[model samples]
Target: MSVRVFVVGIGSGDPGHLTGEAVAALNAVDVFLVADKRAATRDLVTLRAELCAAVITHDRYRFVEVPDPERGPDAERDSTAYAGAVRDWHTERARRHAEAVTREVGDDGTVGLLVWGDPSLYDSTLRVVETIGDLLGAEGVTLEVTVVPGISSVSLLAARHRVALNRVGRPVHITTGRRLVGEYDDALGDVVVMLDGDLACAGLVETHPDLEIFWGAQLGLYDEALVRGPLREVLPEIRRRRDAVRAARGWVMDTYLLRPGTGR
Candidate 1:
């Protein structure tokens, strides 16, 4: 049995972010693997459903809800433990996806996995598909993978702020909140941080008072909010607003860019 998988990037929470290529891919899919992990992120599942409903005109496509793997305390303690936990989690997820593909989709049929933002940026759907292929290949299941790109949160953040991601000919360093704690250096040019549940920018601002920050939460959504100014001046308000928004909505997906400069 041959299975074809389309890892489609649906962009950041907004249906309008879907590209022409993504819409075409949606029409080609027979099954959509939706991840339902936590109550806080249930809205993300709903948004994917809405995207399908809005773009997919055929009734041939169906959704298969997959329970995501849990990343426990191992992900919080250290880098080694965190990497191991993530690897284990992805392996488990690949097993689940392989079963779903073989049972839910017919031979030669195409399956879709709706990824938030572009698959190339901080998303793991492509890696999961590769794992699924490896697992299923032993059972005589051949796999073909296709990636459809969509607007990334990084692009949306820059557009919303009306600023370039880099400074002149300098490079843009993209990293996570945890890494920013120890790896951050002003000499690294402009830095963009994501997956920051801890508000690392608040702490960094204390040391680098001249740094400027452009922060956005729930980018491209109706409740999207952006804050920008000197890190020292805006960090407190960003924290307050982020907390209030998260409390009201149960979750928040935010990204920020930190540059070494004074506020305009």
Candidate 2:
């Protein structure tokens, strides 16, 4: 019996952030798997509650929490030691989630995973599913998976900040903090950088201090904060506010859009 899994993105902690189609699909999911509930936890519960509040089929949903991959001190290192560690962690994470699906399905059953933002975006839930799918396929557990897209953090950020992602006749590059820090060979007209740890804009201005930045954190939440200016002035404030909030909340979710030189 083949296992049918639906990978659905629930947006950034808000049911209102979800699209109509996404909400419908979420309401239709039989079993829901939420990753990293024990660690970086409450938010997932809140997210689930939000989803339930939006949909009428609350009682039909069965939720499972899958442990997230370890993000430790060595997570950022490029050495063979650290690389191996990260790979092992991801593999283990995938294995556990796959095992859960296998055990739960036992034969033919449908399961759904709630991913933050769009699953096809920077989210790694799909990658985990891919790894686990291959593992299960080899073990004779046939798997079929479908992904339902939600409003991306970038799109939310744009709406919140009232900024266009790309200029009239230009292009925008959407990338991660690591890529922003490493090398930007292409000319950046307008860019929205996500998965950043607040140092992304700083890195850009450390070399050229003339860039403009529009930054925001907790976009759809009450604690949302936005700062826009030259990177030199804005970067420090972003770090300061981000650290304080992180310390207070135990977690933070943020995304920023930046442009070289000038942008409102």
Candidate 3:
């Protein structure tokens, strides 16, 4: 009677991005674990619920809303502090997840956590599940995890821009906004930056005035916006539009690709 948890990727907030495997996983689960963090993310929470309703046909499945942990201010500061804070947050979230599973789910029931992007990507749901298993193991609750991969924002970004992620014989470098600031190099080939809250693309444009940028916010959503051109030329518009969008929506999820040439 082991507990089985499926970490399912819902694909950048678009139901159209759902794969066959993701649909099957969604229907197979008896419980869906949803994390309601901030008011800014209410749209995402709604989208997850909408997806569940659209796919799951039976009334046997239920949803469990979990209050997300408070991440310290250190997460927005330095790298070391951010890592430590995230680890602490994940630990608390794992405890909450285990509690929810133990209380709401049957011994052999299948539970699911819908992640925004692929679990193997920048998402931390898989890591939290690992911690959940560790915390419950000593209490005689055995856990088994199954990963169902779905579309990633990187794939959506490239598809929306209609460009290849890499040039011939070159590799693509995927990094976060924090690391992109100091680690960007011309030798890294095409750079795809994600989870950037600080407009790191604008900073990159300042440093490398000739670099080309393909930037998109709220990818695959109804109000999705894209800006592309020489970074210096498009930086102002991107900043202005991004600010306006964030103000309107209360939050933003954006990613970009920094190419070396003019993209010609």
Candidate 4:
């Protein structure tokens, strides 16, 4: 019996965002493995369940929640320490994933891991899945990995803004808030930042006086919010709106496009 793991990107929130391929993958899965983070993020876990219920026509599938291991806070805030914490968390995650796959779906069944955005974009499921394969392998269980891409928050952000990500002849760069904190480079034609609830662009307000930002939160969902304009003028508004969203919903997923404001 072999296990085939499908890392399916379920998009930001909407079930309608599911591509035909993602739907097929959903139907193929015998069990859908989800990370049970905590009470604060329970809404996100429920959202994934609703998405699957809406799209998957079959009732043969089951969902198994894997309790995510708690990570210690890095008071040092050093990049090295932060990465080390993440690595240790992933190691435990791999062990739990291997157990869940075998216990619920068995070695002969297929399972799916629902990723919020495109697996390649900031999500760590693929990396953890790679380790899961190794763990399963050592157990004499054959494993196969498959990734189905879906609509990313960046795509949803562009659609909401009704704007393209890059200027003519300009390239687009995608990065995280942590990286954007200090790695805000000038060479990229356009910049898209994700996974940052805190305004990583706060510092750029003065650094790039001509900087412009297009930001959105809870994208693709009914309560979605959007803000744009000069970095200086919109920074406060973004902070207000972002904080409101978190206060109201207890969580927020946001993405933004930053440009040098050379034109338009």
Q: Which prediction has the highest TM-score against the true structure?
A: 1
Q: In terms of TM-score, how similar is model 2 to the real structure? A: 0.89
* Structure candidate 3, residue pairs in collision: none
For model 1 the local lDDT of residue 56 reads 89
Instruction: For each candidate, give its TM-score against the true structure.
Output: 0.97, 0.89, 0.96, 0.95
What would the per-residue lDDT of candidate 1 be over residues 111-198, giving only the tens digit for each residue? 9988888999987788888999999999999998899998999999999999999988999999998889698888889999999997
lDDT of 4 by residue, 1-264 (tens): 798889999887588899999999999999888899889899888899899899889899988999999877654468898998999999999899889987887657998999987898888898899898888888788878889999999998999898999889989999878788688878977999986746778978777889989899998877899998999998889889889888989888899999888666
TM-score, prediction 4: 0.95
Q: What is the C-alpha lDDT of each candidate?
A: 0.88, 0.75, 0.87, 0.87
* lDDT of residue 40 for candidate 4: 89
Runs of candidate 2 with Cα error greater than 4 angstroms are 37-40, 74-76, 79-86
Cα error, candidate 2, residue 74 (Å) = 4.8
Which regions of candidate 4 are displaced past 4 Å?
74-76
Candidate 2 backbone collisions, by pair: none
Q: For candidate 2, lDDT tens digit of each residue in 1-264?
A: 688887877777677777777777777666677666454457657767666566636676677777766667653666687657767877888899987887665576778887777888887777778899999888988878888888787888888778898878998988877567675533766877887764666766767777778888877777878877788877778899898778877788888877777544
How many backbone overlaps does candidate 3 show? 0
Residue pairs with colliding backbones in model 4 are: none
For model 3, state the Cα shift of residue 41 in Å: 1.5
